[model samples]
Target chain A: MTGDTHYDLEILAELAEGLLDDATARRVREHLAVCDPCGESLADLAAVREMLAAVPVPAMPLGVAMRIDRALADEPNPFASVPVGANGLSKLSLVPALDASAEVDSEELATVTPIRRGRRVWVATLGMAAAAAGVFGASVLASSLMSAPGGTLAEPPATSVSTPERSPQRTLAYTVRASGHNYTSRELSGPLVGYFGPEPGTGSNNDEQLDACVQDKANELDRPPIAVDRAQYNGSEATVMAFWEDQSLDKVRVVVVDDNCRELRQDGLATWN
Target chain B: MTPPPEQPATPEHSAVAGARASVTDADLLARHIGGDPQAFSEIVKRHRDRMWAVALRTLGDPDEAADAVQDAFMSAYRKADSFRGDAAVTTWLHRIVVNACLDRMRRKSVRPVADDELIEAAERDTQLPDQTAEREVSMEVTAALKLLPSDQRAALVLVDMMGYSVEDAASVLGVPAGTVKSRCARGRAKLAPILSHLRNRTDLTRVSSAKGAELRDG
Candidate 1:
């Protein structure tokens, strides 16, 4: 089988790049010593690699830098004012529920209500500790806005992009079936550790498209999601799921996405190191 | 007294915020975790440029790179508690930024763009005509780079363009040094044919310029 076949570009490149084992390199070089085309190809590849190295990395534009600065400034911190470590991670508490509230109705999934976590959820200044878990939600007003007619929202209204001829449940395609039970705002909690978005056909979740979308998100996250459920996050319809940021750590990242697979929640829970 | 004017910044406060430059990266991270409002901001100011460079080179799209870099800083801010101090802070940032790019790439599905289209795109840029030579070569390189797979592009960018040693890049990428070398090798091989025109163009320009210089001297 070891006839007169020329080595592929990658193999020849490996030899030139010093990646091949000594024995293989010797073999390739022996062939190259006799073959002019292979030799020329190797030289050209080396020159190309050199050209790639010649271009310098450009600096981040000033506008982009300022944008990132503003982003970091918005991180949630609970211990900003009190002396550092005075109130440790466990000691950090939510300020009294201000004017906001998170109300969930059990039966008929009725009663669209206002929801609020705590003022600390809105603050900067952190106490670095194990981020046990965050049942992350989208905009605080998502649920209220979904339930109320003609309500103005910071985000555009959630209008399903699917036409009527398409599957009526196409709006549910990106989210795995929720076992036929809709989740209220309060049902989501605890650590995020699971294979992916509610086992595909647990109760009524056999929607193949939903399964496919969830799997796509899993690949993007590099980890299977814990739950991809049809739920009212705050008051908005969303697919809430958890992804492992770094499994070695004790926390997981939770995100909320709408029907179009766009992440609805721009804000995420923060933990200090 | 107008609610006592909300407590003023103590001299103690000025020292911490003012000493941002002198503070070590790890100390700044620690300060951020401790609720120092300005510590994380200072960290971003210091490392964002290098990280932005890495992201832009790996992704080849400024808009995507900007989003990836922003995502990296935000993730790092949230995951500040996860840093174990086993690596340099820059290494940590690189890993976060690289992973963010990978995520975006996976979501967007990278595809190759033809060289002519890219060159046309470059000509449309509003840069001064005097800058055309450098800008043209840059566009050529960028277009050729877009032909590579994301993993190969990332390894090539870190090792060849940004000057990270293969071993160091492997640490940031959480892969073996051997893997980085092979990826770079394969990426270079793939790019060779596509980029060969550049080598020919350089040779031609050099020959023409030398002839012109000789004429001037005569």
Candidate 2:
């Protein structure tokens, strides 16, 4: 205490900050009203607080920020990514998600990480198609295009079986490959003709034996199948169903599922520009 | 305004990132859970500077501050789904970063490797534009803060420097509001005489306290 007659800095500081009890703060205020040094000490403490508040915040170093970015990018998938890439889901493991798999070799299964599960192939393709079509471009580009099942993937280009996983830097590689089918029209009958064989027996939902599979496909797409035809996709007896995604009817998603509702990977269709 | 975009960030990725710039922090965390790979990164990009400031102010060193911030983000990334969302995301984040800083301070205090941080801090990292004044202020601030204990330093940084309310500071520091208030008060009393010379305020008399003499000689 200055002069052995006034309160020390701590009491005065607490009084200044209103941290003291009302009775003690009143006594300190009365003492400070009669004493000059104690008042000066109190004012100086306030200045210190002001100085702290005035201190400018330093900018985060760019190098440090970039380092954080690298560390984040290298982080492996932490948890589940629900819509697609969910573990143990129905994904085409061996067959590439693309229509042109002529170069597919046996080793393609070991090296390529099927993170996409081939289920969102049509979804991501539709998203990118929306970008190309420029109809619902902005919202579709950010939302559906972004979450469009593996719209961006690092696995091997399933479109070309011989390519092998070229670039391993997830998100930036093969995000939007050229669509193999336009999917603009609903006429998959010609390509799916082989599924019905030489004499197509009135193939309009006539496959009463595969009624459950067709309904499962319908339930998955949230709509009734527009056209269901029998096919041997990837050497398995499969049902190829074309789904009209929305009321706009500008987009069509084709799903190839076997006797079970599991989606099968079928890659081999001509280009549709 | 954009801080002059960095390199290796592709135009398409930049555009996509820009499109998602308006996403709320909670939504970004949710999207990360929903399997959007870029969602978490956007969260990082949005909050790095704020967390960096809190970490740097608490640790008073750049390298350690960087590590603490990294640790906090990595922890947050792994624990995104577990966030209960009761508090503001910034509050939860500052808690992580401040906890990281306090942990580092505790470990550093216990370990033999001391004073090396001060020597290395002299080397200076990067020179940000218009950072001269801020650097000087932080240097003085750091020196003054080193006089106090780490708890007091954390409380003062949040309450005074960051303008956090006492309750918010207490929340970030995981302490009672009374504890935060008392720390700030005791810290200010000790800092008043020492920082008067550093800040050179006009209205204050320069009384030489024991703490002031110690700081002056050191």
Q: Which ten residues in a row have the lowest lDDT in candidate 1 chain B?
A: B1-10
| Per-residue C-alpha lDDT of model 1 across residues A1-273, encoded as one tens digit per residue | 134667788887787567778888778777776666666666667666666666645545433554464455334554455643544432223211111222222221222211122211111110000010111221222232233222332132122233232232332322232321222222333322111222211232455655666666666654544345554344445566654454344344666666666777652532111
> Can you give the lDDT of residue B66 in candidate 2?
84
lDDT of 1 by residue, B97-136 (tens): 9999999889978655566756654442212123455566
Pick out the ten consecutive residues of candidate 2 chain A with the lowest summed lDDT: A194-203
lDDT of 2 by residue, B169-196 (tens): 8877878998998899899988878876
Each model's DockQ score: 0.18, 0.19
Clashing residue pair totals per candidate (backbone < 3 A): 16, 1
Q: C-alpha displacement of A86 in model 1, angstroms?
A: 19
Where model 2 places Cα greater than 4 Å from the true spot, the runs are A1-4, A82-273, B1-18, B110-137, B201-218
lDDT of 2 by residue, A1-273 (tens): 224598888987676556788888777766666667776676677667766766655445434554565456446547644333466332322112322322223143222222233121222222222222222112222232224244343121112222233333211111111111112112332322111111101112333446666655555545543344444343345556655443242344567666666767542232111
TM-score of each: 0.52, 0.53
